[model samples]
Target: MTDDRFLYDPDTAVDPLGDAEATRAAGRSSKHNYAKVGSGRPSSLLYNYGPGAIMDLPHFTVMSTGLDDWERMWRKRVDSPPEIHAPRLREVVAKLLRSRNVRLRPHPNQPRKTGLSREGNDLGVPARVFPQWMRCTGCDLLAPLSHFGYTNTHPYRPDQARFEHERCPGRSGSRSGKNASRAAVPARYLLACVDGHLDEFPYDQWVHHWSPCPKVEFPVLRMVDRTAGKGASAVIHCATCGARRPMNEAQGDAGRSKLPRCRGRHPHLDAFELNGCGDATRLMLVGASNLWFPMTQSIIVMPRSANEETSDLAARIRVAFASKPHRLEKYEATGDLEGLRDALDGKLDGPVDEEAIPDDQLAKALGEALTSGESDEDLAKWRADWDPVDLLVPEWNYLLTDPLGLGHEDEASGLTLSHRDRAPGLRKEIVRVLAVERLRKVNALVGFTRIDDVDRVADLSQRMVPLARAARPAWTVATEDRGEGIFLQLDEPAVAAWEAQVEQDQLWLAHRAAHRRNFESRTSDTAGPVDAEDRLRPPRYWLVHTLAHVLIREMALECGYSAASLSERLYAWPGSDGRPPAAGLLICTTAPDSDGTLGGLVQLSEPERLHRVVSSALYRAGRCSSDPVCGMRTPQDTEDFLHGAACHCCAMASETSCERANRFLDRRFLIDLPGSGIGFFGLPG
Candidate 1:
């Protein structure tokens, strides 16, 4: 279903064709695909990032598709991703949504499609987006994409050709001889400050800064990459004024000296300078790895409070009255408890406890709750109170206690966990839970950081970066998903024994020293006291973490899900008297908007399969494709500091699948290494 609110240039027609075929046929591609959705994205392109993210897009097409040109293109709202049905996730997600004052929509009936599709959109779901800047590759002119001409071209059908900005340098160059021959690409460089305001690079001001030549009206600029010297020696020159400057001087500390102050531009939302961010803009290339680092925290859903009953009732009521918000409104206004309950009972296919949540209370709660994201006031409040990393205490409590409460039950409410029979060393060192049912995991995109770790920032306000260009947006797009997993909790005695080792403490200290050095290098601030408790994980953490990676790799080979689809949540902490020590890892598979249970993950957890999977993973960790060199690497300030005997070939998993940002992993701790006796699973004498 197409979002009616999506902005479309009436003059342009967007086709559903995939990007590759259109590019191959030289057929007009969809302009919406650039920053919207589609399989047409180039391999080098990376989107689906939150605010503070920088990406490069080919300038020319803007969006390639059916209608080539437009008299004018207008801006519209970004459509939301399809919501996944997750009644179980509603309680926590609803609380979060409520805290932000976002409206809760009824769960979607069908599973939200995953990945971009060939049909010219993100699996047919397009985000409503309009980027503010575009750069002309031919002339190196940086301007908004809206300033350029529009065209829809199918190589063989020239009769449908059209143009908007006739005088644009990019268009002139592309059409100089005959038909338009070029498309503008997104400017590869953008600037952002610590305050989270992003803007185009001050290219014009930089080149013209040191030159004595008077600024000429309508100056022509060109980017020249010099091959003779260092890569940074590339230059930007103004033909009209004969002004020139090396690109390198405009970047880093050197660029800070030469460039103009930050203009407080937020091109995405087209908003700028309220009080004005006075910080000098730093030079950044689009697609820099640091441009966007998602600050995300996840929880393993476990049956927690009696509140679940109320939450389950709420979800049922929501789905029953989703299509009839007016009825819900009536119930809310009148507080007509009995009538509403009766109406709900008539429509709902399953039972809902009216007693758990009385009609009046439900109405009052729903009334107070913001379920629709259409109101401006609701949005403003949302941005003001946005919480990126919510406290996971409740979720953690649920995960730790609830699964065991189920006893040997194979499943409960579409969720289950079954203990496996003890293997030789399994029961002695690890508590057993072979398979888990409906392991629901919800991940939401809160904010992003550039060249800094938002996770380290203790202040909540500092982590809330602007995703919108203009004033703080009332709401931002986020995703909710569900999945199943395999659970393994280490035996407390085993973990204590492992931590007791003097050599283990030394090894952990070395990794910790490296971590401190790395942290200091990233920020000037001293490590927090909590760093010891949280960041400086015990030796058991490395062992469990590495084992998780090995198993993820082994499971990926045959588990229906790809390695990327599976994720790990490690629970490890040092023990102290009277306090419960936690040590376990939940390796599971999740999807954007599905029930997240295909049974493959749980199947691996079966007693017979668990033995084989764990054994194979440990065996593989004993060796490496880049052996000796990889296995012998030491943790130091300069290199391989965060790792030990762990590399992509052995212990590393995709960034998306790892909770620790792929750190605190060491294969040496999981298996016996040559000249190293630290393996948790005993090594030969």
Candidate 2:
């Protein structure tokens, strides 16, 4: 019988490698010992001795002469590919790929020839035909068989390479897979300034490509000092004292030659030392923020210097009026500055009391409200301040000095208390989410680039951050790894912190609203009123505060807050603690802002955003409130607004006073302090 196993029929129409061909390697037959048959088997003796027997032999097997000869003839190195060491060889090739960036691709169909796919011209070897060709996945560049460095495991043969990831080291960097380029551009993706406010890198400002964490949408701010790594940061020597200082306040070595904090507690350098440095090495100067922004209101407060008589930052600003308070007397008395100052400071002789009346002033003020003629009358009566302090007195009695931080609101804590604590503690997390989302919206409005464009995202985010800061600069954000990412967080803690800043911003807005509304002209001026000049009119600081309100609200809406909410949050009277408390009655909303200056293309009108902002402030924490004047109504009025959210109507006695009234600070005394500089940090430069 003829055995066809191990057959190598080259030119035949019938292929030996056909699907129906049975594998003879695994069968047990006399033909399986074809390589050993010559030792003793009849098959080997008969097959070799008789020429007729040759036709009966297996198709591809030949008999061996002896036992050793059988092994030798069947296992020649030239006869078989190395399959036993396949696993170990694969490992070696993998290691080589890691070390030398080599990859393999066999010629298609295991042929011996192929061409390269790389950009540069590289010739490939032509054999029978390549089973595969080589390709450099890194940089998407490829090379032919001869170019790659061959090693013990990775058959340096060109057709044996595999696919690899394309490495992109960016423009002007390395041709290798790991080269990062040197960049002189602004090394930040997102910037948070010293004020705890956030800004981002604009296209014009960002030179390096932004590569933020794919997982973290809002990247935090970080910075890598080149000097810190290369050398012990550029040493700054003082000219006169010759004092050597390192820069940046994050590290203590920095001095305040240019930076005030670096200068010293007082941060003042004598001319001799200034002459020594001569700007050769400008000492680290304390600034508005790590990131630059012009005209931001978030103040960088200085530490109050001791051993000085006038270093108090909280100095009573002398109520200095660059212009006269817009009182009726200012127009009538030809600017009686002396009389006006005396009346405002409570210098009139008569007891500060409301006059006996037919309620004539209210009637006269109301009658004037209809025609816009009384706007001037309304303005006058509004300014006739029995005592601006009186309106503030009720507020002081209820402020919570000790604040319970976010989340852990226990009994007596600001978060759990009823009235003493309040103000929507504008959480950092809240602000960040809103800022990023709003940036996308603004980008949509302007139509420059998509929300995902790293450059555009950075720019829009920065421009819209003032909305979160609400007129104050928050933090400065820089990038880590030079310019690969962003670092945005609150800058330095204000002497008052975010809570106080919010309160002050809101307070000034209210005070100014009252002031602006006071200009109405009424038919008759009430007599015996603490003199005509002592009106509750807005002052310069108040107007400045109102201006801040306008800007913040505008930005917040551009971010997508409802107009009503925006106005309400902005309107809410923040308590000592930054969250809104029971002072709902104190929330003030007078008139909307003046028309937009940005032409017809960009009209900033958002009633809902304003309302939400104000309402959020009102609901921070309070037992209850009933201020019909502002139309702010709280659902609960018995518990402290900053702490617990209890229903006072159902739980507490109706006649109970709010909890905050009992814990009020001696604000009256604080306000009446004789001179300036009472702040933790003294007045600014």
lDDT (CA) for every model shown?
Answer: 0.55, 0.22
| Top TM-score hit | 1
For residues 5-72, what per-residue lDDT tens digits would candidate 1 score against the true structure?
Answer: 22333333333333544675787645433323222211112133333343333322121111011001
Candidate topping lDDT: 1
Cα error, residue 615 of model 1, in Å, equals 1.9
TM-score, every prediction? 0.71, 0.16
Superposition TM-score, candidate 2 onto the true structure: 0.16
List residue ranges in candidate 1 displaced over 4 A.
1-48, 51-100, 103-147, 153-180, 210-215, 225-234, 308-413, 423-427, 468-476, 502-504, 524-534, 558-561, 575-579, 593-598, 625-629, 636-640
Q: Please give the TM-score that candidate 1 achieves against the real structure.
A: 0.71
